[model samples]
Target: MQWLKVIFAGFIEIIWVTGINTANSWWSWLFVLFVIALSFYLMISACKHLPVGTVYAVFVGIGAVGTVIVDIVFFGESFNIIKISLIILLVIGIMGLKLATEEGDE
Candidate 1:
């Protein structure tokens, strides 16, 4: 479904952030590029069935929060209460956006 595609695209976008950490060679670059392309393609496809503004905002918010968690967990980035609280806020915002969707928008 459209929501599935949107969620997948958003989740995979974490690769855009962490890929740089692993892109020390040409092959890595190619792989990351492929991921980027696929993510965008999925987003575009989902837009056919969902509101672009809602989908984009939710996707970016989820992706940003996901990337931050990925960095902190896997890349040894510093973790703090502020970051945690901000992530909570981001989750709430995403939920609000999703809930705000009109029945006709689905």
Candidate 2:
């Protein structure tokens, strides 16, 4: 379904972003480029069924939150109060966007 496409697109974005940390060599960069291309393609497909604004907001929200989590877990990044607050804000924004789209549909 369309929702599945959106989720897959988000997953691709997360993978591409996480891969950036390991992309030191030229070959790694090439693989990262491929992932980025795939993420865009999937995002376009998601937008075809979902509202463009909603899809874009959700895509960015997921990517930001995922990146923060990955940084904390894998990169030993600090998880301060500010970082947690920002992640919460991202979730709220994603939910607000989805609610607005639902209202428009209704």
List TM-score per model, in order: 0.95, 0.87
* Residues 1-106 of candidate 1: C-alpha lDDT, one tens digit per residue: 8989999999889887689677998999998999999999999999998999999988898799999999898989999999999999999998999999997998
lDDT of 2 by residue, 1-106 (tens): 7666776778778889988877899999999999999889888987877798888888878888888898899889998999899899889989888877874442
Off by over 4 Å in 1: none
Each model's total of backbone clashes: 0, 0
What is the alpha-carbon RMSD of candidate 1 to the true structure? 0.9
* Error of model 2, residue 7, in angstroms: 2.0
User: All candidates: CA RMSD in angstroms?
Assistant: 0.9, 2.0
lDDT of each: 0.90, 0.83
List residue ranges in candidate 2 displaced over 4 A: 103-106
